[model samples]
Target chain A: MKSAFRQSMAWLHTWVGLLLSWVLFFIFLTGTVGYFDDELDDWMTPQTPTFSATADDSLPVLEQFLATKGADLKNYSVSFPVDRTQPFLTISYRDADSKRQRIKLNPYTGEELTPRATAGGQTLYRMHYRLRYMPTKIAYYIVGVATMFMFLALITGVVIHKKIFKEFFTFRRGKKPTAWLDGHNLMSVMSLPFHFMITFTGFLLLLYTLMPLIMNAHYGEGKEGRDAFFKEYFSRTNVKASGIHEPSLELKTLLERADAEMAGKPLAWLSVANVGDKNSIFEAGSIHKNLSDSRDKWVFDANNGELIKVQIGHESSKSFYYVLRSLHEGLFASTPLRWLYFLTGLLGTGMIASGMVLWTVKRRTKAIKSGGGSFGYRFTEGLNLACLLGLPAGIAMYLIANRVLPLELSERTLWEVNSLFITFSAFILVAVAKAIAKKADSAWVSLTFLTGFLYVLVPIVNAITTEHNLLLSVLNQNWVFVGVDAVCITVAMACFVLGNYLNKIFNVKVNQQEHSAGPDFKRGHAS
Target chain B: MIILLSMLIMFHALLFLLLAMPKYNKQISVFPKRDKKLESNFRHVGYVLLVICIALLIVDNGVGVGIALVCGLLTFLGSLVSVMFTFNQTNTAASLIWLPKKIFGVISSSSAYFYLVGYGVLVTSFTLFF
Candidate 1:
């Protein structure tokens, strides 16, 4: 009975681990990429120029928009200039009807340009955390559940191994599935610290979902308790509007004044409330690209610039959570940390890949010894191959779409998203076919090679598409894009090498199984 | 705030490590009857310290935090390994010596449950305060 229960748990552990491993891989990959989301956005929109805004530039631009669209400016947020890509002094506020309006102006000229609204990298970053399919609440719940299971798998895996340290330094190269499995175990075991940290932090980051039952039980299950909780927690209070009229001051000047008040910290952003109203507030503070330190600016008063109250970045228990959250997100570090995260993320993905492959290998050997495979076994094998190879193929397809599609094309973002799903679906279908044909190993190699090919071409494609070729980019020190592209190419080359090893291992495993099997087993073997 | 939090995390880590020592290893009683909340505080606080240690490694080179976290991990491993060694120990004196460590090992592993609970409560407090 004990043995039966152990077997049942083992079965559960394997299936659950396999089923969710791919999603977790995607989560890890995208989350790692998002660590340098700001850098990516900057790289993507390299054309934007960075300049400090002065009152001379700010007032004229403000007046131009104000004369024609003062009412529109009433409920808009004015964001001060930070970087070159951000050429606009922006106001984003809700109008009388509570409709969101974002008005971007030349802080230098104050002329409103078209509202800049194509989520550069921010969309991807958010989507990584809150999956794209559903509302954030629902999606987070799903993620939380998945994360819990992943933690379980990690623990069970450690428990089952029994040879943790013995296998710590183990790496069986060029042995097809065994080699893959060994690689997986080594990566997972060696980076146990990282994996544990990531999983725990992931759960903590989404603490709201995991323990909402506590909130529901203690606080009321409705908005009243929730709002009260937040209000008290953050020491936030909403001020009632005082009915009066006053002209809004230049946002650039307000930002400078706020920065001056903060003493040495650069102004990251400025927001205006009650714009053109008597109780308008201008808030500005130090630029915090990362949530390492909690320093923010909240300046408010009558529109005539009477100081209401100023809140500098204050550290509280909540702020500490943010700092931890930032640490998990790798926001505090510069380029090196992002790369370290990316490499570790790949190791994580590789770990998952190996685990998935190991399941199939183990199943195939059992089936061969048993003289045939079950329907469930066949379906799982097919699904495994589909997911393992197909996802990368799909990502490649997205990159291809990004380049081939017209730059000014309508719904380009939608097209990019669609292309990913479409390519993924297509590869999955191919995997099914390969699995049915009993060509799983060949399919793996072919898909890997294809992915490699596509990856290596990205830099070449970029060079062809943009004015910045490799030489000029090198000379101009545009290493970010260049380095990423170069790394992709190297990764592609490594994948090809891996594919070759997989092919040899697949042959050896099949041959070895046939050798161990008697004539009767050979008779049952499919071509 | 982070500096203080870091200190608190390290303190817990050090306490757990001390508790898991082969000679000193014994189940800590938050109350006479095995309270999970108290137990998990030790384990989860260890986990948090480990995370902060990693974050510190990433942000800056604070060798002290690193050394403390490492020692905490070694202590955990040592206690867990000692439990196995006790069961296999042929000499009665050796087995007797490991009995306390085994009890402590049980105590430490069980600490995970309480730690998670404490973390949840703390997070709730953070969200409220922030």
Candidate 2:
């Protein structure tokens, strides 16, 4: 009975892992990259200078800049540069034509910095959950299902590996299936806590999409129901706008009062609503420093700077959700801890990639014996190649496109995203064509080499296009740009080494086949 | 500073666990016999040290950040050890059994009196300098 149960678990682990492994790989890789989303944003916008300015210091400069707009501003927001990730103050407001506009400014000088147009890391971060070419709600449901499958796979994997701890110390290299299995096992077991926590928290974050029945049951149907659910469930109090126009108080004064109320906790953002009205409201939100506590926002009368209400702490259920969301986002993480998070996320990506490869490797022998195997085997192998190698190449191409594409090009950000898909689709086509020709090994080697070469070219392109090359960045102690360059070079070297190794393996296989079946068979089989 | 110290403690504990494995008994010359009691004792001490390190981390950085940091550090250390052992066959479990013996040999060849007097001098100098 016990053996039967173990066998069932092993079966479950394999199928669940294989079914969503590709999407999970994309999710994991993008999410891993998303850990440095802000840093990537900084690197992409090279025109923005790095400077440290307190909220109090930047608020006045921001106000003066807004006053110069010469429009009856309605509904505007000023985001202070509270951390290194965001070094420039950002003002977002509706222009005279009622078109929304955003501009970054050097807080000290209040001089506008026109950074080059790019999709930035925000696109990559959103793609992890929202995905592309699909409605966001549909994408969230898909990603949520994949996350739940990941949790299932982790649990079943643990059940099947009876000697989990013992296997942690064992890694046999230079062996066919054993090597891959050992790698998958080692990565999974070594970072089991992180994998489990990330998966569980990721699922929880998308619970609204996964299980909308609760909201439906509580508030009935349609958009009004959803809005009502959020208003009540989140304990939000809405004040209606009064049409009486009045001049608002200085934002600096309101910020000071909010800061005093929150005991000097740094305010992350301020939202002003009912602008140009008598009942205008200003909400100042304090950044949450720990996952256990919820963020606090103080609402004040915009005209008088009088405190209206303070929203701090969450109820029981909301607190639980907040903590889970915070853990997954890592917003409170310090430098060392954040690096650790990134490393662990990389390991999770490796675990998923290795598992996908191991699936192909485990069946290769059978497939070869059966004269190129079944349709499923060939398709899986092709996809494995396309996803594992093609995605990185596509990402590298995307980064390169950001530098090479014309800044004044129409819909530049859209084209940048399009370039990624186009490059990725091209690689997928190559993989599929090579798989059909029975030259999968060649496809892997070429794609990996291209990926390595593209990554290597990114820094060179950056140097030609911008002044923040590796040397200059290092001299100025700009670690964000320096780190991006260093990581790119290191990844390039790794890819080159991998490509070389794959070439050697392919050569050996060819030689063996020739020796066994003579020249005639080799000629017929050669693509 | 505390994170670094915790990482160091975990690394040494993992090293101790690796050393205590029965598979390395043949490779290591200093500990020829399979001392089960010694291995058990080392395991206990390692766990205790890990617990203490975790408590210290939590006290220093609060619950949410502390747990995340510890997990991250642990994963980092595990990956480092796995990579090191995988690439260098000489550092694998089947080797490095004589590491302790070699270090002990260097210290044992000196006179006990001289070693004690050197230790005393080092301690006194460290105290005075600080």
Candidate 3:
């Protein structure tokens, strides 16, 4: 009975893991990359200047932008590039037509900069949650379901792999084909806290959508109710324009006081809303220093700089929620901590990728005994490689697209995104084709090599087209751009090493023959 | 710098803890046999080192961020150790295990070393956590 129970659990773990592994893989990989979205943004937009300018230095540029361009606008928000996430003087206003005009200016020079449009890191970051080519609501539901499964998988994994005590036993032999479990459990226990934390926090992030009925019941029904609930729960301020023209006090005075109020919070974004109106308000919000609170905000009356509202601290429940939200986003993470997040996230990705790979590994013997695998088997084989290697290859192509695509082209952003999907789809086809041809090992080896090649091209193409080439970036001390180049090269090395290992796995001759016996060897040498 | 320091300390802490386990001793330990007294000593030292790591981090960073960072670093280093074990990379483990083995052999034979670490952990934790 004990054995049966364990068997059932093992079976459940496998099937459940396999079911959503592809989607989860995509989510995990993309979300991992999202940690460095700001850095990627700097890399993608090579026009961004590197300087050590403070908020005080950028304040004049902000003042000038508002004095000239924002003079006639009734709703404008300006923020100095005080934070690493957004390193520019961002002035956004509505024109006479009420069409929003947002511009990035050099904080020191006060000159407007027009960066060529490409689907930057923000898109990739958004894609992790919102996903692409689908309605956001549906995507939320899908991701929420995936998160739930991920949570379940973690729990089930723990339950089944209760032999964590065995991890200490170096001499133990697997009485069954539980190499996957042994590996999975060891890796899981190593980072189980993180896996659980990230997943649970992620699930909580979509709590409103996941369990909308609770809010609808309390706050009243429909979208209006949801909006109302969010406004109160999140403590968002809504100020409508009164249309009465009031000469507003200079923002400098308010900001000085606001800075005093904040003390020494690292990430502060100040916005002036209902601009030029009687109800105009200046809001300065700082994400907490140690990440205890998400934000401590101060609101001031635009006319006289009198403090209107001070939003600080929440109830215990709300405070807990704030901490969880901060942990989920990791907004307060230093560069070192951020790298830890990325590496751990990659570990999570590896865990999922390995499980997905093992699903096929465990089945290969049976499939071969039965001649060829079923459609589902072949499809999964294809999708596994597609998710693991193909997606990254596509991402490499996306970066390459940014560098190589015509800068003046209309709909460049769309094309850049299209390039990613196009590359991804091509590899999907290659994988599926290779799987169908019963050369899955060759497919893995070749795709891994191709992924490495594309990654190598990422830095190369950047060097060819952009001023932020590796040499100049290093010389200029532009670490973000240099990091991008360095990471691509590192990724290329990783791919080459993995490809070499995989080529040896089946002793697949397509790559191995060329590697060991030169390119003269033919396809006939493959097993 | 705190991250690197924490990871390094934690690595030693984990290594000591692993060395205490007899099964791992059978496979990975250079001594090739477990000394029951030494195992007890190593285990105590391991737990104390971990306590010191967490306390040091909390003191340095703060209560909330420090704990959170510890959580992250714990997972990262734990995964790394897991990888080493998984690959059965005894060479790497042996290299890491060398200093700790030498130190533990000398230190574990004497209870004073354990007492000293325990006292340090207590003082640091008391000063900060209080």
Candidate number with greatest DockQ: 2
* Global CA lDDT computed for model 1: 0.61
Task: Give candidate 3 regions above 4 Å deviation.
Answer: A50-52, A69-71, A165-181, A243-246, A274-278, A508-527, B85-130
**Candidate 3 residue-wise lDDT, A109-174, digit = tens:** 899877778788888878888988999999999999999888878887877765665453222223
How far residue B115's Cα lies from its native spot in candidate 2, in Å, is 20
Residue B59 in model 3: shift from native, Å?
Answer: 2.1
Ten consecutive residues with minimal summed lDDT in candidate 3 chain A?
A: A168-177
Model 1 alpha-carbon drift over 4 Å, by segment: A1-13, A42-72, A80-99, A103-120, A161-168, A175-178, A214-240, A246-253, A289-292, A302-316, A370-372, A507-527, B1-130
Candidate 2 ranges with C-alpha deviation above 4 Å:
A69-71, A95-99, A235-237, A244-248, A274-278, A303-305, A518-527, B24-32, B89-130
Top-scoring candidate (lDDT): 2
- Among these predicted structures, which one has the highest TM-score? 2
lDDT of 2 at A189: 92
Taking all chains together, the TM-score of candidate 1 against the true structure is 0.69
What TM-scores do the predictions have?
0.69, 0.90, 0.89
Q: Order the candidate numbers by lDDT, best to worst.
A: 2, 3, 1
Instruction: Give one digit per residue, the lDDT tens place, for model 1 in A162-245.
Output: 667544434555565666667777667755766776788788889866676666676677787777666766665355456677
